[model samples]
Target: MDFSGAIFEGGAYFLKAKFEGGAYFLEAKFEGWAYFLEAKFEGDVNFSGAIFEGDVNFSGAIFETRGMFAHVEKIEEEVKFSGAILNRVFFEDTDLTKIRFYGTAIENAYLAGANFGNKRFIEEREAIDEERNLLQHITKALKKPGLKSILKSMFVFFAFPDNSYRKIKTKCKPISEAFRRAEDVYRNVKLSLQNEGDYETAGEFYYKEMLMRRKRTLYEIKNLKYWLFSHIYSKLCGYGEKPLRVILAAFFVILFFGTFYWLTGTVTGEGITDSSFDYYYFSVVTFTTLGFGDIHPVSFTGKLATMLEALTGAFMMALFVLVFGRKMLR
Candidate 1:
């Protein structure tokens, strides 16, 4: 039954209608309310590029096989799938602002590239809260408790792919409010996965969760002391990933202080004249706090530089040791 390019000027109903073969609704336009309540599709179904100008309901409907509902251009009002059994449904590259999946069993559903636009996020949150409240009422309608619970959990887990995580991260990369929303969703998903005992997948989500938290700290929270500390920690040790960053920082510090010592001309020694090599060597010696007694600072600037460099060197060396130990242990 192909309704491709068909236009419905008023409300349309397919209530309790059963399609035993292939069904197509490509490019169909629904100008008023669209109903598919309890409709059953026994074979493949396609609804690509459909435009729903008014509310559409598929409550209690069943898709027994694969279904395509991608690239929907617009849905001016709510499109609900509550209590619908959607099997291997594809909803990619669609604006999902008005879509709701409460109480839906979406097994192996793919939602890649779907845009849950920010405008509907508040409504979506409210819907989720309402659904949570209504769960008690809906639980009484369930026939098989264990199987439904397992299938629903699996559906929730597979509805969003790992690449979807990257999409959320990229979309929320710049704005703090968007990132907060992304983080909230990410943390919820991670917790759900953990609760399901899927530790491996949960670990990946946990990493993303921490990364979002770090980004939120850097961009949204605006805590100065923590920001500064985290910034320095990342640069010096790459958050404990790249030890070479510490080495580079140490080299830069040595060069800067060495130049300062040479310019001040404050070091006096028996053989160390106004030579660049002598100044650099003396700088390294002072930084390491190895006072050989042959070369000493003759001025206040040199002494101050020596003290500062020594403290910096001590801190850097300790940090390197700690980071290196962590890496080796890991």
Candidate 2:
């Protein structure tokens, strides 16, 4: 439901409906699913500290400005951002992507089917950024009795990434072992993403340490978020249409040779002798280097034909091998 262009201003509100700036959702919230597909914006759009019970589908949604999502609590359901275009995306210490909240529409976080930025969650978080005035915010949040419970749950995600289990082993005892165990899981998750060409995520494990040591967000603490984005964007989108082009080139070569070979084997003489078994077989053997001597060329054109067939064979094989290898690596 788009109406923001007709309403909304530069402040926050607890609205009962949607936000649409011509179609941008800027900084607004609904009580349930938030939909703002096909919206255009001129500045940053923030969806900070909002909640949704249903899937967050932003497929094909275009944001001319950066998109900010943070502090969304208890959204234990699938969160989809497929095909949503944006200038920048921010996920600040968001635990929902890593921790599945119980109840509501989500029975389990896995069942929630959360897909964070190309299915690569847990990017280099611990770096200088997470530490962003760590003492300031943690101390501030710690003072609020209301935030204590949530922060305790949030610690399951924040503190456990580095096999901190041993370093903090005696620091926390017995039941707190779950915290260490969770840290191991977090590290494994980060490792898996790193293995799957998600270095930004794997890097987060190290970055998180950077933050914990220094106490801040990577950008705020170290200004490395810019570098992180440069690396992540390239890996995610990669080289577009190169693979597609190789496929097209292959088809073109196949079409050219298939037609040429088919025509070459056609009966061009008055009575047609040796059909095309000899010609096609000759082409195959010539291309494959299996030069059996039973088939001898009697004419100038026939002997010349053998040489051309051999050349085509080499070219096609080389081209196909290159194309196949590129696809496999991609």
Best by TM-score: 1
Deviation in Å, model 2, residue 283 alpha carbon = 1.5
Give the per-residue Cα lDDT of candidate 1 at 145: 25
Model 1 regions more than 4 Å off: 1-174, 181-211
Worst 10 residues of 1 by lDDT: 122-131
- State the lDDT of candidate 2 residue by residue for 240-262, as single tens digits: 21234444543454454434554
How does residue 280 of candidate 1 score in lDDT?
Answer: 83
Question: Roughly what TM-score does model 1 have, to 2 decimal places?
Answer: 0.48
lDDT of 1 at 17: 92
Q: What's the TM-score of each model vs. the native?
A: 0.48, 0.28
**Of the candidates shown, which would achieve the greatest lDDT relative to the real structure?**
1
lDDT of each: 0.67, 0.40
